[model samples]
Target: MREFDVQLLTDAVRRMAAQSNQILSPDVYAGLVRARESEDGLTAQSILDDILRNADLAAGKAMPICQDTGMALVFLQVGRDIHFQGDPYEAIQEGVRQAYEENYLRKSIVKDPLRRINTGDNTPAMIYTELIAGNQVKVSFAAKGFGSENMSQLAMLKPADGVEGVKRFILKAAREAGPNACPPIVIGVGIGGNFDKSALLAKQALMRPLDVRNCDPFYAALEDELLEQVNNSGIGPMGLGGRTSALAVSIEVLPTHIAGLPVAVNINCHATRHAEEVL
Candidate 1:
């Protein structure tokens, strides 16, 4: 069995938090470039151009992509063959605090949900842990800003609603979110799991690269078909109206109880920021 230092996990999380805020993934960048070329509306095209330029500036200058630096959310997969040297949770939180302060990331997290007092250092990152079968620990950081996160939704659909119902539900969610989630978006749809699980699944789906699809052939086809339908809405870049409002539609599915079909839709703005590291 391999023993890993908790400090390494903490440091990696911090680095990921800092990196995600400044860099748009290469796949996302390439997709946006393609959209800029094919988009017909001059105004819409201009908006896309500005977005690309801003992303470039963010990376080059080491500045946060958006003013909202976002709350840090870490997901970990710890292998059964691995042993941790220190307190894992504290390590993760310390990493989050140090990263935000040192990287100059804005501290948007509040201490009390009801009181709304700013924590000042973006500490207390939301972390999820899962045990797996390897000898290494894999950490992924997704800095989710409140603007787009607020626009997400979960629906407990009737069993009779079926796949068509799910399609309509997601479209309606997108329509309601109009321009708020920052157009030229990447949509994550989670279906079949319980409400909370479905919601988390949708957000996690955002971490997958823009061009990748579900390994399941059926879900892959659904992802492609959904992307086509969402783009047809003509929400365009930044809601200016064009053929490329949404860059991709990704879905994650899980088995559910026989009584209900729960669907969750998580919308990520053009500035979707995520990074991962394994140790």
Candidate 2:
């Protein structure tokens, strides 16, 4: 067995949280640049250029790309043979707390849905964990802003609804979320799971690099089709009207019951902030 200090994990998470807020990942930045270059409308091109400039300034200044630093969502892949000195969950939360406090990132998490009390430190990160074969622990961190998150949707579609139903729902969600969720969005889709699992899968899909495609040929083709349809919606950059409405569409799927097909859509703004580390 391999022993690890919880402090190390804490430190790693803290740095990742702070850095991710400022630096746009290479894949996402490239996607933005591509959008800017290909956008035919001068207004949309200008918007994409401004977005790129904002990202550059944020990284150079070590400041958040957006005011909403977001709720910390941490995904952990722990090795089965590894052991930590302290509670993993608490360690991750401590990291989030330190990142928010020390880095001057905005604290957006609230204590309760109904009471609406601010958590102050952004503690109690939304943590998901899985046990894997290796000895290292991998952390995938994302600061999920609420603007796009609030526009997400999930529906338990009948199996008869099939792929066409999924396509319609995704397009409708994008059309409705136009301007509200921020345009040039990244669409993460989850299909073929139960209600909650589908949502989780959708959120997880956002963690994938924009350039990567689903391994399954059918899903990969579906992703291409969805991207084309969404970009053709004329939502444009910031929904001002153009061909660059969406940067990418990613889908993740799992097996489900014979009678039901559940689908979830998670939308992310242009500043899709996420980072990863292995320790």
Identify the leading candidate in terms of TM-score: 2
* C-alpha lDDT (0 to 100) for residue 176 of candidate 1: 82
Question: Per-residue CA lDDT of candidate 1, range 1-279, in tens?
Answer: 998889998889888888889998788899899899989899898999999999999999999989898888899999999988998889999989998899889999999999999988898899999999989898999888888888899999998999899989999888888888888888999998798989988988888889999999998998888888888889888887998878888899999999989999998888888888988
Strongest candidate by lDDT: 2
lDDT of 2 by residue, 55-126 (tens): 999999999999999999999999999989899889999999999999899989889999999989987799
Question: Candidate 1: which stretches are off by over 4 Å?
Answer: none
TM-scores for all candidates: the values are 0.97, 0.98
Off by over 4 Å in 2: none
The whole-model lDDT of each prediction reads 0.89, 0.93
